[model samples]
Target: MTQKRLTPTQFRNQLLAVMDKKHHWAWPQFAGSAISKAQLKIHFQQEYGVYVRDFPVLLARIHGTNPPMDVRRKLAENIFEEDTGKLSLGKSHPELFLTMMAGLGFQNGAFGNLTLLPASRRYRTWLDQATLNRIWLVGTAVMTIFVEGSINDRQELLHPSKARSKREIESHIKRHPLVRFHGLSPAYMDLSRAHQLVENGHRHDAYDMVVNHTTTRQDQETILTALRKSLRLWLVYRDGIARACRLTP
Candidate 1:
């Protein structure tokens, strides 16, 4: 008998389990005092070459391109509210990206030259094909469910003060003009609060549960593959907008 395909939620849960397990192993390899605000700022300026303040404009430019109405509208709202409003902490400190990038050790110029990772490339290529073929909703699913969902997770992790020095970080983020506007949005706040609940529930020790439940190398690979697929789907999302705008050469 053929096995039943998992629902999206079920699939996501499985993927999270794998990530949680990986996080335990990966965290130690990457963690250090080097993941500091000052280092993050230096890394961002030298490597990414784009400040957090500029992110909204980039997003706006992409969103402004004519696309399917729903996709355009969602991107517009998310970009505007995120870049301009209370959540706009990204714009204010600009260093947050540095902090994040530093944590991931993604500062190498070599990384910039790459279009996408092996897993992400396939997913993006698929999305581009789907979008060009007019499978618009499929493209949107790649964006809203996976790409945006990942950002939401990262934001939740960063927002709450896990460190004793969180107040310093919060102050820097809060003082930014864009972040001020971000906080004003009720929808954004609501979504943030909900995500916070999830993050809070997943204690560091929860990795034990994740490992025990997943139980096998095959299961671990399956979850990793799914995450990679989701990331690739996000590239399709970006390209879809580009296509809609007739921006692609």
Candidate 2:
């Protein structure tokens, strides 16, 4: 029996359903309240090693698969901004992250050599294989939809950042835990600023690439399975970080 292919909208809804669960219980502790500098350093180190540092390379792995012209173009644009930040800021996202960390008194070298927690390494190892999967759509969905798309993805798609004024944006950035608690000054928040600037189009582009370019029922199922795995692994990964941070939740 032939399976019915899902419409782009339907597949996207399912993907968003998975993303909605991206939140960890301890996230509120980490984001909403204050934590020690040690805790914050540990958390950001795991994060940098896991994804922040090599995200562009991960995207490039997907692009190297050569899925389609449109897909390639979208991936290229994402890679360009993440690696160069030319379209938004003048530094790479990872560099900007280190700059933000500097405001918290973390040296750039602090992020250069760090060990991943057990669960963190497990999740990262999965990313290694998944992003290099033979079926490009599996890699694409895992990275574009699951990795890049956040829990607020639905809101991002519906409202977009254009609705927010620059003041409103800066206000939100000022409220970040790093700024409010760790004393990371808003002046060093160019990473957050860069995200706000480029994210309006990038979020929509990520959805368009995954939702519209997918062409098969099998590919649809494959992508969904990959995303589900990503969600599970990511949850465990976040749990490990929370434990490292001595967070109860």
User: Highest TM-score among the candidates is held by which one?
Assistant: 2
Per-candidate clashes come to: 10, 0
Which residue pairs of candidate 2 clash?
none
Q: State every prediction's TM-score relative to the real structure.
A: 0.34, 0.95
After aligning candidate 1 to the native by TM-score, how far in Å is the CA of 203 from where it should be?
A: 17
Q: What Cα-based lDDT does every candidate model obtain?
A: 0.39, 0.87
Across residues 1-249, which tens digit of lDDT does each residue of candidate 1 receive?
645655444544564543333222222211333233343333233223321334444445445445556557555655655444444343322333433443444453533443433433454445444333332333333333333343334333335435324454445445432235322223223323322323342332222222333434555555446455655444454343333323433
Question: Candidate 2, TM-score vs. the true structure?
Answer: 0.95
Per-residue lDDT of candidate 2, residues 48-74 (tens digit): 999999999998998998888999988
Worst 10 residues of 2 by lDDT: 156-165
Judge candidate 1 at residue 152 and give its lDDT: 38
